[model samples]
Target: MMGTRRSVQFGDVITGMLVDGVDGTPYVAATLLVDEQLGVRLEVPYITTSDTAAGETPGEWFETKCPPKNLLLIALEGNISLFDCRYSGHTVRHPAGIAVGKITPADVVLQDRKGDHSDPLEVKELRSDIDGLTEWTGFTAITRHPSVDDENRVKKLDIELRTTDELIWTQGQADMALRTTWSCDSTAEGLTINEGVMLHSTFPAPVPVLTHLEEHRKVASLMTFIFGCPITWRSHSVRDQRFTEKRFSQLIKQNTVKEAARPDPTEKQLRHPLASPSQIGSSGLEAWAASYETWGRFIHPAVSALNSPRTTLENVVVNAAVSMEAAGHLIGEVDGENATYDRRRRKTTATFIYRCLARTGWDWSGICESRVGLARALAKNYNTIKHYGRGDFPDPLETYLVSSTATLVVRLLAIRQAAPDATSEFDSGRHFPAYGRLVEDFKNNGLFIKCDGLFAVSS
Candidate 1:
């Protein structure tokens, strides 16, 4: 029996083995076939090493050719397992970002992390919380990329948000109609990718990016999206109008008495996107009536300077003062009797500006100082223009300082009106070390009488 078995096993083993002869030396290799119940596998069928000679480095360059680095994945029913080079198998990890569900083999993709990041980031949703994705016809996604050098170090990034659809939250279902887009493009001198700023080559960089100014625009746009204001290129200012209970009651009665008021069940209804402010150009006649007479005194110049540019710093100071005046009036307390501009010939004292701003919440320091600085410079430079006095012109630095300050105040006002809730944290109740520009609106009516000897003169 031993002799008969040996003869049969020898024939079978030789058939499975490979024999190679080189230089009178014969090398033999064999493939082992395991039963279904056995859990054995051959890791490296063959290894080639740089240190082939006995005197060479022992384990320096050993590599295997028979065992493969490639993994074979097989999916059956709802389970996926990976098979080894020797046909032994084990389960692999399920990828992230895919929701819990039976994954069909068709959904799998073969990819590695070696592609160029400069390419447009295209994302396709495989699974979503909201059902019927096609219903999101108005969906839009936007990404912004600022310039970054290859090393990816940026001075500061206020925001590098990767967003899909300013509207249409993934978890929430919404329907809205709005269409507007703006892009600015310019070469970045010192910029990079993702150590700070991410790269989006398709979406161009901001146009005419004059540094800090462009950053302001970016913040304003982000605020617009957050506050759910009209998604327009024009930054919408948040106007928080609150009326006291007594005042609200009075207003209701006054409207009712005026005879056009009506209470109707049919009138209380939801609005459609066709008439959505986001879709329609403007909020129409109703909104226009409440808006500024000339956009905004401060914002007008920022968007496009007053048609022709001013040549002098004196003009710049004066412009800042005027913008601050408009902005200051919107915030702080207002005198009911003198709500309108005072008719008397009196310069808007720094004290007056200060008082008005002091009423609102001011979380930032240096703002009042900025305003005062602007006002002081304006008063002096303004005297130069009004009296034709030879006064030193406001230097470029002073001009920019005051201008930026005025811009900040005006922006605050715009932001106050646009995103009132967000501004709550930065209370404008006037930040200190106090400045004289925080003045109350006062007027000197030029009404004075004097008695000289027996006669009285009134001027």
Candidate 2:
């Protein structure tokens, strides 16, 4: 029976739940010491790249355990500040982009101390008092996730000797390979290993467990990236919005609106080209939300203002129409002579959707007002897009349309102009566009409309 200690030490036994995933695997957690002493005392030597050697004494470069294929080596001192794992991936080759969750906790174990395996007489357990402790501390520390084949299939075993001592084992290592049990035919078989198994007694007994944390850890790091820089969001926002704006600009240059780009002019299409235009509209709003949510408080006031009622449906329609026309004008100018009907006609067809939406009291003016607001919102969402200016706008426009099914704009146009009487089908709503399929359709039909339910093309 494990004895209860008055206080837990860095090596004290901790009981945590094991989260089993889709395979015959289990994740276990144990209290372990994490600090610089633990890093240095371990005999394994490591070389520090200049990028990671910040404010530290330069030591002789030593070949530690040849880094496991796809594994990164980390060094520690005597502290566990947020900085403990900060410099894990700073090299140009590794870049700060390396995912750190794939490395197993067991892989970070310390060799057992010769005679210190006994439980300490009086151990006081360390309690975490910091907010969001999960983000910085965990019994199972996955130092890094290397891009290795079938990384998920590997097993990691972390054996604790004390609150501050741990031994790590994995299947891939030679001298440190873990000893594992294979239960077959109701009989236990001796585990095979290339290296001698090293076991150590830790202050703690059962370990605290966390499993399937690779993806979660990546998410946490990404969150850190956002919190640390805030500008990354701005950069992405700039790229995405600029991408859209550039596409819009391209549409303006190309000018010709091909009929094929429009929704099939059938009874079904007349009612709901693309399919669920409303959902597409909602998606645009959601995209705006996702972009803004990542930036926190670092956005312009006008950018934040998108949440204001100025984004009413009326505003969306008006801006959408105007923007569509602007896109169309751009397209026409760029591809006026001998322009492929597929591309040019598609732009024209898209504009037609705006015209129909306007005729149906869908509020085209509101969309126009919001166009600038949308641009502002995008600028707020992404700073890079604003500064860089998208070289080409058509692609991003297509992305937005595909994501929101706004490309049903063509089908909507066919319904309004070709067969207004079939307007009742509009109630069916718009569906999201299948980008590949739709693009192909646009390319194939060249001004020919494929009529659906209510969107019959007359001319």
Residue lDDT tens for model 2, 1-459 = 323221212222233322212233333231223232232111221234556554221121122212122111221211110101112221222433222111112222111111222211111111111112122222332233334347565355543222222222221111111111111133267543221111111123222111112111222222222112111110000001211122101010011111112222223322212222232232322232343333223222212221122343323333334433433343333312122123445433333333333433232221223222222222221222223474432234323322222323323432232233333435433222333344444344321122111111223
* Per-model TM-score on C-alpha atoms: 0.29, 0.17
Instruction: Report RMSD for candidate 1.
Output: 28.4
By TM-score, the best candidate is 1
Error of 1 at 341 (Å): 13
Worst 10 residues of 2 by lDDT: 230-239
Report the C-alpha lDDT of model 1 over 1-459, residue by residue, as the tens digit. Answer: 111110111112111222111134232232322122222122113322333443211111121112222222211111111112222322223342111111111111112111331222122111111111111123323344556667887644353434333322111121111222223334566543321111011112212112212222332232222221222121111101111111101000111111112121121121111112242222221222234343365444432221123334445555545655655555544442122223573435443444334433463332222433334443444344445456665445435444434434444444444334433324533431122122220012211111110111112
> What TM-score should be assigned to candidate 2?
0.17
Tell me the spans in candidate 2 whose CA falls farther than 4 Å from its real position.
1-315, 329-454, 457-459
Model 1 CA deviation exceeding 4 Å by range: 1-165, 168-290, 305-316, 328-352, 363-387, 428-459
How far is 305's C-alpha from truth in model 1 (Å)? Answer: 4.3
